[model samples]
Target: MMALAVDLALALVAAAAALSFWRLLIGPSAPDRILALDTLYINTIALLILLGLRLDSALYFEAALLIAVIGFVGTLALCKYLLRGDIIE
Candidate 1:
């Protein structure tokens, strides 16, 4: 059933989100943490999209898009800082 499939997908995405969070917390280096953070952002977006599908609403999808944009910018800033010791100039 489609409902069952959506439920399974939601569970899996939630598990992935948890693992990403754990990595974000326990990463051994700054770059590792940054990668984990990016992964977390992606997992968060997946979770949101899955939730939207499960709930049959468009709001979650929009929120996911917003998070994706913000997360991307944040990741770029973090990487830039790591590479140059500063985000700007």
Candidate 2:
């Protein structure tokens, strides 16, 4: 059933989120942490989309889009900082 599939997807996404969080916490280097953070953001977006599908709402999708935009900017800033020692040159 579609409902069962959605439920399974939600669970998998949640597990992925948890793993990313763990990596964020335990990463040995700054770049590793940044990558984990990016992964977390992606997982968060996936979770939001899945939740929207499960709940049949538009709000979660909008929130996911917002998070995606913000996450992208944040990731860029982090990478820039890592490369140049400063976000703004």
Candidate achieving the largest TM-score: 2
Q: Model 2 — which ten-residue stretch has the worst lDDT?
A: 53-62
What are the C-alpha RMSDs, in order, of all predicted structures?
A: 0.9, 0.8
Q: How many clashing residue pairs appear in each of the predictions shown?
A: 0, 0
Indicate the residue-level lDDT of 39 in model 1. 91
lDDT tens digits, residue span 28-75, model 2: 899999999999999999999888889999899889999999999999
TM-score of each: 0.94, 0.95
Residue 45 lDDT, candidate 2, scale 0-100: 93
Write model 1 residue lDDT over 6-83, tens digit each, in one string.
899989988998888898889889999999989989998998888888888999988999999999999999999989
Q: What is the lDDT of residue 71 in candidate 2?
A: 95
Off by over 4 Å in 2: none
Clashing pairs in 2: none
Q: Residue 50 lDDT in model 1?
A: 80
User: Cα lDDT for residue 28, model 2?
Assistant: 87
